[model samples]
Target: MTADRITGITLSSVTLPLKAAISDAKVLTGRQRPMTEVAFLFAEIRTADGHEGLGFSYSKRAGGRAQFAHAEEVAPDLLGEDPSDIGRLWTKLVWAGASAGRSGASTQAVAAMDVALWDLKAKRARLPLAKLLGAHRDSVRCYDTTGGFLHEPLDRVLENAAASRAAGIGGIKIKVGHPSPAVDLARVRAVRESLGDEVPLMVDANQQWDRTAAQRMGRALEEFGLTWIEEPLDAYDAEGHAALARSLDTPIASGEMLTSVAEHHELIRLGAVDVIQPDAPRIGGITQFQRLATLAEHRNLTLAPHFAMEIHVHLAAAYPHEPWVEHFDWLHPLFDERLEIRDGRIHLSDRPGLGVTLSEQARAWTVARADLREGTGT
Candidate 1:
């Protein structure tokens, strides 16, 4: 066997083009063009034994380069360290960035590294990431966020939901927080009317509203029986979320913007959200996500992982409780493999690691690349 130590790390930035601009309440409210570019930061951790593990993080519009730089900055700390020691490496990276990046971009960078480390561990064990993490289920229910953007026409939105349902997807979520509560409500109502009562429907406001608006809109939209209302207000408004949670029947799902497991604990301890939506890459990757998942299970909260479905599908499947994964096809070009979504549920593959590898399409999109060796750069 080769040295079990991590020898180097390679990084790349993939510029993904959206088929069309995608808008949500925040885009409409802020008057910014719906984001048309997705920046994907990829990390490939190489061990002395010639095995490599793949991990990635993404920015909706910017910061992909910054994340790659941060990952490079942390690479030295991982040199000669066992890839199986995921926890130690994660802590090391977190502490290294604590002064400058206790959260946000630094944490996002850590996510890419952490995921690569986990993939290494799973591959060494010759088991899939889910099984390595202790599989709670082979699949998880899924909901599509693709069709329900604020910019789509009502008919298109309805058709999107109908198409998703007809495909056997379990549920669909649309964007809310349009300028007018009535406008947002009308869209929700229209989807409800189209889908009828049986299918699950969710709405994401992208934190575009204030407490007053969230409360009012949450109340007004309550009639349609939403599975949950996502980010009705700002993500950090714990007290506001608690109050709204108490007032509404729909569960409040948040935490995607939060960058640490400790932050998730604060959100849950405060009764801030009924369903926790943590993004693995936004946090510190798989290790931190497992911590959050354990916390959610013990706290009796539902787990609904935020995007990067390719990575999250495995994590959600390993969650101790029933979990949901958001469906977004924007990253399809980045990976050679993807988890399957059938009959509205996502099934994880048994292949070792995260079950995905960078695709040639991803290679074509690479605007920058680097290979950092153990003793070459400091």
Candidate 2:
């Protein structure tokens, strides 16, 4: 038997429309407008052995076009490469677009490719990605975010939290950091009361606050007993986050925006956070995520990946520590499968790889696409 090689690759740029314009702290703070859609880069890899794998990366509000463009530019480099060599291939793609640098859109573009290779390997082994990576559990604790954006009225936000709790979601996280401090406090109080006690609850400031504001909100928020206060300061402000962590009884959580392992290391090294929320797609995909996971585990920190429940569920399941997965149903329309949520957890299925297949609806949503074969692409 001979090792198989990748025979072809396909990439699609998908525009997924949000049901309504959604706003968060960034929008309220005037940094970005409400987001009406998300851009996705989906990569499908086929090997000579006829095994296929699918992976995708996404951007919201901005950078979707950049992600697809960069993936298209560097995707041909994977032709004829061994699909099982995920790490080396990741390094290969990074250097292929070295001039564009190693993080942000550059790495984000290739994240789909890195993810596809991992999926391919797991499918070949007939195991789910979590088992392929050595799962610590079959089901991961999950929380819902779709219902709690800053744009929703307090009543609507409370309704969302109530619905999620009834649906077996283990936790609820609501947005804070409105320009009006009183408004922020009121919403948190409302949801906390609606949820009652015993359910894990958290809040995200989305990095909209200065140190003074973060401290004020953090102290005021103490009575609710949150699981964590997320992104209370700018994501890269490791020193500031460390200070906030020390000052607050509520654990500080940040790092979803850091684009590389090196950037996340600053958080780990400074003891900046009690919970580290790394998004696999926004970083460099699973290879980079695994590296960050190990670093976080060593620090005895809680692991809670930011979003993409489909991807994060598997990664969280594989973590040695019990970790939480953000459950957002926004991407539900793109895939043929749905994650099983029961008993306040996201359960993994036995299906090989990521346990997902793209839907016809996904194809209908594609705006641009390409195919690459040995020595040729179209």
Candidate 3:
């Protein structure tokens, strides 16, 4: 029997509150909000066979309503379309939004749709997402980004790193680029001391520093043996990133804020970063992420996806190169199940599709929603 055609789509806006008010370098410097507000647009694609595939895309804050609206605006385009032809559907959506530019919030909204379509396709094939995408491994290594905020006291910073070490996490990333570079250096030193010299340590400046600041601070911080320094320069400043990369022995990792593989390719072509961190929710979902991952692999660059570890775990496992998934448990409340982490790596589930769905707790946080069916008009 032929697989069912697409029938309807549903979108919802969910708000995720941070466990605590966490601050990054940008936030501490008053460049960003002190509290993290996670706004996600959840999407569900229904088929004529009575199957539904779930997906979501998130914003740092306040954009979930718009994302949901955009998804609702585009949902009808998939009515009666083949869910398996995700690539073609993705192209159609992109072209439909071409007049409004091909990236940013619009593309992010498209990501919610693209992800759900992939989930539906994999479910129809009766294979887990990783296997459907071609599994390279059953698990991939993970690093904790939860403990690495700039607002915590130095002792607490060290304690966080120590806790992650105690939990068997492979590595930890700390926020950097404080007003006093000395403060940033001291925190890193303390964390490294607590975790010991052998444990992998990474730092994220969150694109707060200029080329000169990056050069000065990067040189000073080199004594501590870090795995990489992330986003020291702005995401679009490929030349500046290249210069900083050349100046420091520490690998510079970036691309989380970038919207497309084409943007990532520009960074890669400029030799800007050693590790590329693509956030699928921001980069138009798995289809675009796979393209970027392939490009990173071909260039011998490391793959360390930005966030949403639950999803990245499978994608990271499928990559030819060893990939690192950032662990941020703040959003864990949204999922029905917890990811299985063992020996510093996250194991992919064999369950069909993404193997996870919205939790009741997540439903409690829903603020707005939209439903689209075959007869609906944008």
Q: Per-residue lDDT tens digits of candidate 3, residues 1-378?
A: 785788888888999888788788888778878776789999899988887899889988466777777777777888888888888988888887777567788888999888998888788889888899998999888899898788888878778877876777889999998899878888888888778898889999999999889999889889999999999988899999998888789999999999888899999998999999999988889888888888999899999998888678878888998889998878778988878777888888888988888999999999888777776642
Query: Candidate 2: lDDT over CA atoms?
Result: 0.92
In candidate 2, which residue ranges exceed 4 Å CA deviation? Answer: none
In candidate 1, what are the lDDT values of residues 1-378, reduced to their tens digit? Answer: 544888888888889999999888768777566799988888899988888999998887778888878877776788888888889888998898777667788988888888999898888888989899889899899999998888899999999888888776899999988887788888888889888888899999999989998888888888898899999878888889989999899899999888888888888988889999999998878888888888899988989999888888888888888989998888888888867779889888888989888889999989988788888754
Go through the candidates in order and give the clash count of each: 3, 0, 0
Q: lDDT values of the candidates?
A: 0.87, 0.92, 0.86
TM-score of candidate 3 relative to the true fold = 0.97
Q: Using alpha carbons, what is the TM-score of model 2?
A: 0.99
lDDT of 3 at 41: 90
Which model scores highest in TM-score? 2
User: RMSD of model 1, in Å?
Assistant: 1.5
Candidate that beats the other on lDDT, 1 or 2, i.e. the better one: 2
